[model samples]
Target: MKLVKSLVAVAITVSMFSCGNQVKEVKTLNTEIDSVSYAIGLNMATQFKANLKEVNDDAFIQGYISGKDSTNLLVAQKDIQTIINTYLRKQQTAKMEEQRAKAAKEAEAKFGDNKKAGEDFLVENKTKEGVITTDSGLQYIILKEGTGDQPASPSTRVKVHYHGTNLEGEVFDSSVDRGTPAEFVLNEVIKGWTEGLQLMKEGAKYKFFIPQEMAYGAQQRGDKIKPFSTLVFEVELLEVLD
Candidate 1:
């Protein structure tokens, strides 16, 4: 009877120990599952916040809010804003480039017209003297007579004083402003000066009505002159040193 009682006590103790081990294992597994689920949930929330920030800061969204009703049409508003912003930027750039090209073309045209006009004036004026006539029906008078021999053909070095005006009697360039005589070579100057100086002897002065071609051509000498303008000048021959 004593041996049997001892064996029964040993069996009960082994069973209790086995049951406690099973309970501990189950608790550990449950804790691991709960931790994984929490991590997944946290990650999902973080991803959502990032997406929200991106959508809010996008330019398309801002544009939609400016023009459209966003309260009821969120998707449509966003789309419209994107399209409108893109279109406007492209249009603005294209228009600016077009304006630049147009300005360049106008400048070129003015220059060509002035050059042609000057050539025509030289052709019409047949007489060569201190005085000259322009095709534009303007006339120039000589003021002083030069004594030195004229320079070689196509040569440029010469010194003179000049006063310019328009047919309506508008004064333009005047050497008297700087209180000094203007100097330039014939070849280096406008067509009008080149042709006109050839006719002058040393100590001779001539007045000229220079068309745009003979003056600055298409370019304006200053604010007072315009493109394709006509000019008048009283030139006094001081020296022909070339």
Candidate 2:
């Protein structure tokens, strides 16, 4: 009965496609495809367009058209290759650094209040009941106790649920939000997790306060996380996978 309903559903879907929008483009590629290529291409064009002016767009599109038509003779092939191999990397790097500086300046303007909040939070948090601070500056409070065997080494793989945030309590990442458990080698994570998990057993839950050095340090991860950012995590060890 389920199979029949599924077949009917498929038929209805097919009929909807057949009766509604008929794409006039020829299927020269044989395998099923859609306007995704055009959509993606248009999206990319808009993104680039946002960073450029009409004159720049005209120049780029005309140059591309020229390339497609094999009409280029103005610039030497070697010069074009040199532009790509030599100057492009430097230009891209400069642009990225400029963007990073801009982001840092903006972060100072936005979450500056919480910039020192983590340090203060940790200072008081460490004094709380059952809160243990390791010599290396990792602080954790046991949320749930486990009777299962504790991981013997950093090489052990474990499954866990975690929610990570910066000093300002802005969430950086969360397996809980994704509604999925994370499985990873114990040592493969940040130093804080590597050391903190060693004190845990299967079915154990702990809230960890990881200092900036133990986390991403002075380096940035993507855009949201900034340099020298302290992190807080609520980690639950679900299983010792290996």
Candidate 3:
């Protein structure tokens, strides 16, 4: 929602600047509109990325040229209007629904492989030395003990550095790689983090093995993190920030 709002504001601001107070005359209206159109293109180009599979730059520019001069159109103008009708906001709900269904099916197929791999990994991981399995199915191994006696609690906000990976050992996210410690309330993160952090004290380092249900569950995150992934993380509790 914030992304959409920011992009819309940028596009509007660019258009407004191109048609300033002193440039409202009818004689130069076409010229002013051309500037506004290019401004809008610049605004959208800054935000949206295109793919060769979907549409390339050449195809996009061809569409723009066709729209600008409808007379020399390769196809019937009536057919072009029909395509525009398809793009109307009111007509997109069903199309989006269909796309969502297709994506969900693809995710399901991927998760099928994920589930089998996760089950095998956890089964073998539990047999390793110092690996502790809790009643909630969270697993962890303490790498270093804390100097302080204070353990983390649900309401406690703490500064910590962490590195996360999947069962295949692919690094997905890391505060350590970014060279920064993150602060978060114990209860506000993934269920695995909330449970695992409470078992640690200040300055302690631990590695957590989190099942997907306790992490992202069925939701597909960005380009890296997928649906129903079993995650591993090495987390160090720096200090309770609040």
Candidate 4:
């Protein structure tokens, strides 16, 4: 109900602006009522200017006048609500797409080479004797195989020590360096961790070569890892806390 009233106010303001020259302007606000009315109009005009470029001013004014007088209404109230909702949702989607496109352009200009570097490294890494590549492009080498049981499912919590690095082997994060094991539900982490951890048993150590898509993809994480980076991690599954 509030949104409907707001849209009506915006439509009225847009219509008034479109037909401003035809309407006689009142120079003097002699009465309190006249001053308040002028203030309200000014406020609405400022608020209405946003996202109103596509509005049809003439049609809006006709509808506004007709609805106010409760006469000759062309659209049902429920239909009007649906129309407004759909239009607003489409506008929001368009704005988000524009933003994403702009960001992709910027990322390509900056870290475009990073993606190529990761792809080249992965191609060679998969052919190594100990390295195993999964269908999803996740590559790993078992440093130590554990005899204990693996995590029951992706939802299970586990404690582990890890050393994380980019394709260049520059260390980014390490539970080993911090001297504390990290704990989390496997599904809550990145795709690489979620899938790789499930393959390991308790007390097993594996070195994962996670492709960009399984990692952050186009997202920048801190200063070391750029967009489309292939991440390397030495993970030791200490315990699977069901």
Models 1 onward score TM values of 0.45, 0.51, 0.55, 0.69
Best model number under lDDT: 4
Off by over 4 Å in 1: 1-131, 134-139
Model 2 scores worst on lDDT over the 10 consecutive residues at 7-16
Q: For model 4, what is the error of residue 124's alpha carbon versus the real structure, in angstroms, after optimal superposition?
A: 1.0
- Rank ordering of all candidates by TM-score, starting from the highest: 4, 3, 2, 1
Model 2 Cα lDDT, one tens digit per residue, 1-242: 22222222332222112322343344443333334444443455564444333335445444444444458655554565554345445656777899878877776676565456656777888999999999998999899988787888999999899999876678889999999999999889999999999999988999999876688755677666776677889999888888
Better of 1 and 4 by TM-score: 4
Deviation from native of the Cα of residue 69 in model 1, angstroms:
69
lDDT of 1 by residue, 1-242 (tens): 22222222232222212322331122332455455644443454464353332333344333323333335443463364465456556765777788866764687675666555555655565365654565544457766666877756657588888877754467767886666998787888888888887878778877777766467644666766666666778888777776
Question: Which residue pairs show collisions in model 4?
Answer: none
User: Which candidate should be chosen as best, given TM-score against the real structure?
Assistant: 4
Structure candidate 3, residue pairs in collision: none
The better candidate by lDDT, 1 or 3, is: 3
Off by over 4 Å in 4: 1-5, 8-49, 56-90, 146-155
Candidate 3: minimum summed lDDT over ten consecutive residues — where? Answer: 17-26
Better of 1 and 2 by lDDT: 2
Candidate 4 lDDT, 1-242, residue by residue in tens: 44456656644343233343344467798877666666667765554565444667678767766676678888887799898777777877888899988887788688889988999999999988999999999999999998787998889999999999987779999999999999999889999999999999988999999999899878899998899899999999999887
For model 4, what is the alpha-carbon lDDT of residue 73? 89
- The candidate with the higher TM-score, 2 or 3, is 3
lDDT of each: 0.59, 0.70, 0.73, 0.83
The TM-score measured for candidate 1 stands at 0.45
